[model samples]
Target: MSVPALEARGLVKQFGALLATDDVSFTIQAGARQALIGPNGAGKTTLINLLTGVVEPTEGQVLLQDHNVTALSSSQRVRLGLSRTFQINQLFPHLTPAESLGLAISERNGSGADFWRVAGTRPAIVAEIEELLTRFGLEGEMDQPTRKLPYGKQRLLEIALALATRPRVLLLDEPAAGVPEEERQDILAALSALPADVAILLIEHDMDLVFTFATRISVLVAGRLLTEGEPEEIAADERVRAVYLGEDAG
Candidate 1:
């Protein structure tokens, strides 16, 4: 069988006396849409950190495709086709989306050191930036300072920046956390349009978005793997309802 796009085996993390992650194991198959949902403090962030090398695992292994990247740095992981968005938007306040994306793409192509000098003149980088802006629906505001764009657009741009790396596996942490209801559809539409060949692991609290985007869902509680199943199966699982989903899980 082909190796999964991303895999975590026997993952564990300890901070002082607390166990942040406990024997966690999961796989994100190529092109799969997976959601990881849990209540606050469920160690969701810790798990993402472990996968991306934001912190080392106390005991476990992280694999990208078939390669063992357990000891790789965060930058190393990104170069290996693993990319992620944080719960908080990490945008350069003063730079326009075009500049940010140009820098990211240039870096990925080993021309980042001169991105500023070539941003306006490089045909290839400019083309890719324009393409990504169009893909993320930021064409109208592509040249505006990132801080001046609407919060939802800023969020979308952040995702676009991640995509600039052309990752095989994408990890999204609460992509809609602060997006207003009126603007959330834009985020949804953008996510729905992503290439099917890229595996996605979304960590979010919005159940509606979760059901609409994920074919499969994993529930986490108290730093452990609670259960995982299809969208319907998870919605009907009483254990999930009691702990995280609550009475209106569906």
Candidate 2:
């Protein structure tokens, strides 16, 4: 059998006396889509940081394709085909969506700072950017300055930028946050359209979207892995109900 695309073994993170991640272990198989869900302050963000090397782990290891990447830097991880989008939109405010995404692809190719050469001047790069824009449903908004685009569009732009990296594994942190209900379906549609070869690990609050896209779901609470299973199994879990979903009902 093939090794998982990504795996965490006994991962732990600490700041002073508080344990931000408590011995979490999980695996994301190649081509699988998994969701990470938890209540507020459950250390979801901290776990993401640990996986991407933004924060060093106090214990355990992170493996990419069964190779230890625990000590790699963030940029190094990106180069290794691991990319992520933030919970908040991160973009070049003054640049149009096309320009921003083009720059991201350029950076991934290691030429992002070639300011004298306009990204549009490169035919191959331009074509790639346009393709990604269309794929992400941003073709119509491509030329608009990122700041002028609506919140949902900006969120899409962020995902587009991350996709520019051609990641083998994508980590999405709250892709649906702040998106109004009316626009959320579009986001979900775009995500569902992503290539099946790209393994995606999503951190999202919307149970509906989570259940719709995720093949498996992992629940975290107070920095620990509460449980992980199929969506129906997680939904029916008594411990998950008492700790997380019960609050959603209230």
How do the predictions measure up, each by TM-score? Answer: 0.96, 0.95
lDDT of 2 at 69: 95
Q: What would you estimate as the lDDT of candidate 2? A: 0.92
Q: Name the TM-score of candidate 2.
A: 0.95
Candidate 1 lDDT by residue in tens digits, 1-250: 7789999999999999999999999999999999999999999999999999999999999999979999999999998899999899989999999989988898788777763574657898889998999999899998899999999999999899999999999999999989999999999999999889999999999989999999999998999999999999998898998988784544
Worst 10 residues of 2 by lDDT: 111-120
Each prediction's total of clashing residue pairs, residues at least 3 apart in sequence or on different chains, is 0, 0
RMSD (CA, angstroms), candidate 2: 1.4
State which candidate has the highest lDDT.
1
lDDT of 2 by residue, 34-121 (tens): 9999999999999999999999999999999898999999989988988999998878999998888877788888787787875678
Quote model 1's TM-score: 0.96
Which stretches in model 2 have alpha-carbon errors above 4 Å? Answer: 113-116
